[model samples]
Target: MSSRDPAPTVSADEGVPAAAGEPSSAAPVEPAPVDVPAPPEPHRSRAAARTWALPVGVGVLVAALFTLYSLAQWRAYVVKSWDLGIFTQLAQRYAALEAPVVHIKGPEYNLLGDHFHPLLVLLGPVYAAFPDAFTLLVVQNVLFGVAAAVVTWAAVPLLGRVVGALVGVAFGLSWGLQHAVDAQFHEIAFAVPLLAISLAAALRERWRTAAVAAALLVLVKEDLGLTTAVLGVVLAWRARRPALLWLTAWGVGGFLVATRVVLPLLNPDGEWAYGSRLDLVAALSDPVGLYDPAKGYTLWLLVVVTGAIALRSPFVLVAGPTLAWRFLSEESGYWAPTWHYSAVLLPVAYLAMLDGIDRARRGRVRWLRRYSRYAPVVGLTASLMLLPQLPLWQLTNPGLHFAGLRAQAARDAMAVVPDGAVVETDVGLMSYLVGRTDVYYLGNDNPVPEYLLIDRQGGGVPQEWGDVLQVAQILHPGVPFEVLHARDGYEVARPLED
Candidate 1:
């Protein structure tokens, strides 16, 4: 025991103990010193703890790079979509502990109606501290980084630290994740890391860890419940554990509860909004119609990036629900690999590759076992080749370092509008204004804001500063409105007092 720790009043050995005032009967006896051998377990544990430093270090490095890229894009006004603004507004409401009434979607539209993501509320405390759109962006970047780290850590035991680290680099530079970064912040940002942890645990047959992680996906987004069901199938089939069959029930039941019950109740229309959007019957009837070149390309890319070796593992089955819903959806964005749609697929692909390789190494097939050793090299090569065409390539360009005229114009327009003022806006300045001002999308259903903020280049309402007056006239005809700041397609206007 350390000197600071209190000593036991009595000796551990009964014979060695005696009252302080009362003398021991057998002469003066000295307590024998015990030589406790230092357990090798603790030393091994410390060494094992030291072993994980590589994965943690690698994840931090990759996350830092991603965070830098995301922040740079924000600084340069690289508005991919209005998603960043929408998520920011959701965070704002959650921070205030208010109902998620996002005006940017429509007048007091509870975003839960559009999509079920109570998990986004976790960002409430974060937004409470920073209260900016970039806060969400940063959180997403960090999650992606964490996913990469988990992937690396998983590979470490099977592939060793160096190859595992390489796998992480490939994951960081993968198309799905890079595209997610390009698409801006999304609710699925939470899913990427969770799935990574789940898939990694599945690789080692940690059923409890895998199922628990998959269970959480339903909260991140409603449809992930089906994804959880698929995970249960994988676990049941691979582990041969009948008890795990309950996950399928949990998943399907949760999806039903979230969609039919929770979503409709929270919805502004008192109905499930996206229930009818899936056209699976039409897709199945005319199989030719389901043949989207983009969809085909995304599917091919999923396996090819893993050297097509990931197909050997059943863990890839976890991705079936996500791909099924995407291809089956009527939304064109869902069919494409771009945007934030495919980020969930990347981790699955990499994990499948590792699982496939690890399993192959032990199999009877000689050629396959020999080939598995070189698979990581192939995956790394593919990722590097594709890096030039993806978003991370922006890091190599010296031109991306500085903010351009459009960014300056956005700042100028926002500066003219005072903080806390209600402003109706387009996607261009929506993210910029949502943090400090009340922002509503330019739509007839939403209430008229005190200030009209539009970008002639922003689309929907206006694309340039010069177009603000026309939008004001269209919305409020015969009501004189003063153009407050109109420059470089970013404009702000307020209705004149009578």
Candidate 2:
């Protein structure tokens, strides 16, 4: 009764209980919404907004400086190949309205007749347009370098942007390094870009694009087609099912059409035999000494790594064919050795490596996760190991700044022959400079034109030239010759008192 009026009870649902001297309850509070800016576009650099400007600018400037320095020293580091002389001659002949043809005579000789390779044919127009071979060489260097970068960019989805950029840099730099060892415009270099495109298309599940690329690969070189076909099969298998059928139909059908129909239709003699060395095991075993394991280990490593990676991804279907070809296809004993041929399969290798690295980096594949961090490291290491052999900048300039020892040798060899007389010489440059055609074999059994102009520095000598049945010894063993030219340890000669 004493507190009945004083203690007014409040229900929990009505409101808050009051403290001794405090207000009953505070007004209900609502939090304000937080704001966040949307993410910037993918291609744009968010880092650039803050402190990236200085670093980015510095990096670009450094790169430009290196490019200029490399460009300046390009000519001094390159070596010329014998095949380049032949191709240049063909191009020059084409420019002079002469129908040019590549002639080969050997057990594995390709009988392809006048079947114009788009790349080889390009030489005609280039030679017609340029005053010197150096111009065409420069163009080729720039083209392949750009091609490597493009391929790396396009192939990155299998890995990621960062990895892809690494790949691009590796490929571009490696290509530049190797350019010094071979002819700048050799079909080998030209085929690289095409290979990259072909592999990318195959991986993208574009059967038609892959097929066209495969066909073109074959058209460029018969052996290349087989390699491409192997890669196509691997890609198709990885894609699986109905898609595989379409890819197969497209890839194989296109190859058949191009090799059996189009090429043959264009050149009656454009036929290549599946030689014994094309056997898979035989090539791997290097049964014929055409493939040297000791010398080709670096290239083989690339093949093995790529093949293993492709097996783990959908691209295995395409890579399978490539793998088979890498071990099976016969190699030309030309500018493109077995290792060089392996370079053509780099696109497949790159894709495989990318897929493997991605899986490893994502920690998705149990087998790959353990080595994830090291995958790219290994790849880059491999690239670095392979880089020096393929010099890129060297291709831009012939090391022949002035007629040096080789030129002097050539001149001396030329001096051995009579003036205004036909001579057979392996040194085509000396022949061109001396303006003599009807060049005959050194020791080849074929009829010697009037003289035998020999280059002491060339490939020992055509095997046919060494035999008594060959025209050189058979026609005139005691033919008097002068070493009219000598430069870079080369010699040009012609029979003088035959």
Q: Could you say which candidate leads in TM-score?
A: 1
For model 1 the local lDDT of residue 462 reads: 36
Candidate 1 residue spans exceeding 4 A from truth: 1-40, 43-45, 398-403, 459-466
Candidate 2 root-mean-square deviation in Å: 12.9
Model 1, span 46-101: residue lDDT tens: 88778778887878887898888887787887787778888999999999999988
| TM-score for candidate 2, residues paired by index | 0.60
Ten contiguous residues with the weakest lDDT in model 1: 457-466
Per residue, candidate 2 scores C-alpha lDDT tens digits across 1-498 of 676567774433454454577655665434344465888665545543333333233334323433443344332322244444445555665666665533211112222333324456566677778734454455455545544555565545544666656666665545322432233445555666666666666556676765566556655654455555565566556555344444445445555665676556545354533334357565557666645463366455554434345445544444444445444555434223232444554555665566655556676667677665566666677666654454433334434332233444444544556655655545344324222343333333444345554433443455455422233445566554444454453444444563
Best by lDDT: 1
When summed lDDT is taken over every stretch of 10 residues in candidate 2, the lowest stretch is: 102-111
- Please give the lDDT score at residue 202 for candidate 2: 56
- The local lDDT score (0 to 100) that residue 441 gets in candidate 1 is 82
